[model samples]
Target: MTNVQGMIETCVQCGECVEVCPFYKATGNPSYGAMAKVGAARSLFAGEGLTEEGLKTLWLCTRCDRCVSTCPVGISVPDIVQSARAELRRRGQWPQKCSNIANAIIEHGSPMAAPPQDRITYLGKDHNVREKAEYLYVPGCWASVRLPEVARASFQLLTKAGLDITTLGEKERCCGLFLIDNGLMDEARELAEKNTLLLESTSAKTVITECPGCYDVYKRVYPALFREPNYEVIYIADILKDIVEHGNIEVKHSGRKVIYKDPCPLARRYDMTKAAREVLGHVAEVVEFEEHGAEAVCCGAPAGVKPLYPEVANELAGKLLKEASSKGVDQVGVGCPFCMHHMSGVQNGTEGPLRIRTPSQLMLESLASER
Candidate 1:
């Protein structure tokens, strides 16, 4: 129902974007490509309904923005995908699974489909630590519920550094990036209001998070929505750097060699890979793997692209594991929890010559050794 003619006009329908899209490359499909899908999505503005074939085409895109980065004309493909999904939802033609996830986020303050009662289990028996803290650690939904180990490491390292950090008891809400990804703009805004109030109650100056999605939303979206002076959002990697720079944490390598898996947010867009390197460099012998930096491999977790395009996701992750494994390293460090989780599964011990670690684990180990 929404018109996308203005946005769609930006795409010149050039075929250059298809060659770089991992989804198109692995599936050999055009529906997910920049030109074809961008063109198809444009028709909806005229009230041309989405057919079964057209739905498959729109769903094929991973929405990773590889095309947007490569496009000479500045057409944003991911925004188009989001608009397409929103239009479908408007027409009552979107996927039920999409709303199911959104429904859980609205009802339970998280997208993990988990009970709200266990949200603060990551506090880890340190009652005095959280109650009298200066930092509030929001591990985000996926990491707090699904990826507990990485969440644990991020906390232990921070706590061990002697910073008083705390989290809400059963009151933390989803940071709402996923909702925005699904084009549920109103819900995303609502979740932000709730989380902003929660942060204000805690009065913590800094929020250390394990998930980049959470960091992106809290730092960028929360301010725009709330439009007030509030707590700062810091990624786990940056926090590690802070601890190291202030002489609060130290890492001993024991001769461990590591290859960095830069989250696309940090490596390409924000250019924070150097800080990530220094954080890990103090602890381990650090090395750069090929396809890192702006060209780094994606964790293939978000965008729901993993579900519909498993083979393509697997291919992208598989290639990274295979390449890193061939490098004869001791460890592969990933900053994003989703990246750490997906890459860890594919490693399977034998798939790589190295083990994958959350960056926080190494920092925690360093803190433990120093003590």
Candidate 2:
């Protein structure tokens, strides 16, 4: 369990973060939000016990870091949630997906449990992929297995830009952030070692990935866990930002005024908001939302909250849709596939014009500027 003593002291039960909480606003349940969770964690350290509801509360958060960014004292909700999750996991209250995912990652190299040979299915072999490339594309299991099309435009653009990029085929495994997030530190470490070994064998100087979860894990978590590292794993946002800033890639998208949905981990956790906008700036009439940047609300992805509480997740999307639609932006550009998957689809009860799109898709119709 995480030591709540420090964070508890930091959080004076200030209700400042209540407005920023997606869950709290959705469920009308304070305990599900940051301040309430902080109080519950503090109580536990003060000899109060965790109940079923309290444990479930920790699981309901998407770990989007909105609360922490909004908190005046910098109390980390994810760190606290992780601590509680680890404690719950120790006590065997972990969701079935935890063991299921961990086992899959351990054996199959990623949580998808598909054979490692299938990773190549995300992108086809038709392209002239090189052995010594500038960037290595490591799409996580979700992107590789379920959402291959999201990164297709990126691959097309990269090829057009003459990047000698290569993929790991079946060799690329999980970056292991999921395991680490749920407290499987040792397993995450092992996966990191495997990934680092594979990356070391490649001539790629930097890594570009479409998944923010994988991006965060590869760039941040692995180095912290493994203690040894090589190769700079970068988010596609950063890479694209460079390509645009350096005049390597040209963009000329100008159909609809769009808003970028900053996935929590992608925006706040990885600090890629400005760079992402800068890359897409040339192509898109990117409208800035009031709650953007680190303060950007979760589209109810990540942290596995959608599965735990569907209504709350829906309400979150509803609320966010209203917020974005109020600003008169029709299209919402998402960087993470998970965000796109959750936010873009038509919710059964909602009626709004908030269409979801991945940046790669947005860039597809936009003509590349003269290189």
Candidate 3:
């Protein structure tokens, strides 16, 4: 039996995962917690049938791994949950939107359904993509399709540092974190293989990304699934500390108060709170939100939760926006494009008190100050 199955069978049912789960805490539903969901999956694998609602509960998980730290048995609940999701998918039962996302990624090379040409639209018609460069920037789906400025700002920052950086233009595919999180392993693997081939064809020795989801998948998930990527995978936030310290990039003191919203994958999964904080400190006065770091609140729609449960996602977003407002900051610096997208949705609709800006955008402001 697999280690995950061993852990599941040996689980003491101590309810430790319940206390740390944000979705379970927010919805107050046992099905949303890791303990109940894993037990349900265990029963199904043991030849017991679950109701349709029981199956839906598995897809409801965000795969945050917050429960892993609290489990005395050291069970990786998220892995078990993903295994359950794959079983459900095999039975022709899965979230419709998630399935569509997988199809979109397979058909269009992106989950956003954007065309290949659109990926390079932000680069303008006159810009060129180098065939051989030292760095290759993969601007994931959100940044390349939905938020072009974030991609633009990231490109500008890297170029300003005198690095020989180039983007893949249309060849770069979605990093497939969305599929991996949803238990679409086969789809994720296929996409990752295609991306890996394209990535290796380039002369770049390093690949940089601004999206935390993409960064996490490349740095952590891909290596476990396939051979390590030929080039290094780096999060832009991780490089900012070195770039700023060496005088490669200049960030003027704005004297403005800004609080950083740590992306869940960065803080809880990868422990990147310090790196994100260092990047923010260079641009503005860093302030703390009420709940921060590992304990920070989940931004309502971290993965596909927004499409699966819009009301719940918005509720979490509203609550987080209120928390940011009380901090009395001029703006909130978000490292993840996923979080920034939803937070901006809340900000735009209600014209909320505090503004939401990407850390790269804030850095761009510092660069603009020179003019």
Candidate 4:
């Protein structure tokens, strides 16, 4: 029922997409390439049935939309892949890893299956939290569970900037990004409704998040899937940009040359290319990746790829880090916590001298020096 065939027909098979597809570049497999995935989507829509390898091909995509950007006919391979994934989900053919993630989100409110009570431990006991505030900070699952330091740094920076921010704490839920990415639309919708109500209950005028997945879902996907959110959704980078430009807090330069990697959802999908750079430029000498902004490469961890195909994900991350090291930067800065998590994981395994830090973390370091 999805116009998969119509979309497939529009493709000229120009292979421009091959140049940008990280999955294909990492694997060197035609099936994992964007064009082949488009054909697979057409087959799935035509009811040709799913094969084991065919399903794997569909799941390999991070849905970064690099192919869509390069398409001569403007055919969106990510759109076709999403349709195919929805079809697979309808047939109960989703990968077990995806199902497990969905279950964890459903039962535990986190993809990592972390306990809800432990969610706020990262914030510590002595902190500024109110029942209602002007801005609600949703750190998403990654920052709250996996990357507590990033969450704390983000909170410290915002509070230092004198913003009236509060968090959902134990009541926070996964933005259902994994479910949405895996085509479990019904589950994603349920979480969207629940989170919308929970966030609206706070009477907050603005919703700020450090997670690109949460920002994208709340700002863009939620409205299309359900209704426009009652509060405005903003990325923390934008807020940090404001704070830095207005001199809300005293910051000293670190004299560290760093490459800032742009998150695909924030940079490509939302055109939010400047905020993170503006913030980073104030504290460190910000360097650009070979392909920066809309053309920047993905960190290769989103949309279930990190859990399902970690080798490929690591490969992509390694490539980025190698390039950064060659550029002679002291560190690689990212706006998205997941990018930091993935790239740092890879950096830890290697002897590379590069360090990974978010703009918030870097600014926090600068602020600490002043004390």
**Model 3: per-residue Cα lDDT at residue 369:** 94
Of 1 and 2, which scores higher on TM-score? 1
**Candidate order, lDDT descending:** 4, 3, 2, 1
lDDT of 4 by residue, 201-250 (tens): 88899999989989999988888888997799989989988888888987
Candidate 3 lDDT for residue 179: 79
Among these predicted structures, which one has the highest TM-score?
4
Question: Model 4 Cα displacement at 293 (Å)?
Answer: 0.6
Q: Candidate 1 vs candidate 3: which has greater lDDT?
A: 3
Best by lDDT: 4
Question: Which pairs of residues have clashing backbones in candidate 3?
Answer: none
Comparing 2 and 3 on lDDT, the stronger one: 3
- The residue ranges of model 2 lying beyond 4 angstroms of the native Cα positions read 1-3, 43-49, 125-131, 346-354, 368-371
Q: Considering lDDT, which of the candidate structures 2 and 4 is the better prediction for this target?
A: 4
Q: Candidate 1, residues 1-371: lDDT per residue as tens digits? A: 23455668767777887766656655567665566677668776568876665776676665555566787877777778778877878888767676777787888777666887566666666554344357888887767777777778877777788987787756677887767776777877777788888776788988877887787778777777765546777788888888888878656665677888887756555666777788888888887767677766565656665565566667677777766767777788887877776666666635355677877877777667776
Off by over 4 Å in 4: 49-53
Residue clash pairs of candidate 2: 250-369
Q: What is the C-alpha local distance difference test score of candidate 1?
A: 0.72
Model 1, C-alpha of 266: deviation from truth (Å): 2.9
* TM-score, model 4 to reference: 0.96
- Show the colliding residue pairs in model 1: none
Model 2 agreement with the true structure over 83-202: per-residue lDDT tens digits? 767666776767886678778888877766888756666577665445667678877776776667776777766766778788777677877766776767777787877787787677
* Tens digits of lDDT, candidate 3, 1-371: 27657877989999988856767766778777779878878877886888765675676667776778888878888888878777777888777887888788778878778888888877888999888788988888888888888888888888889888899997778888877876788777777677777887887799998898888888888777776888998888877777888999888878898988888888888788887678778878899977788877777685577888876777777777777778788788898888888888877779676868887788888889978
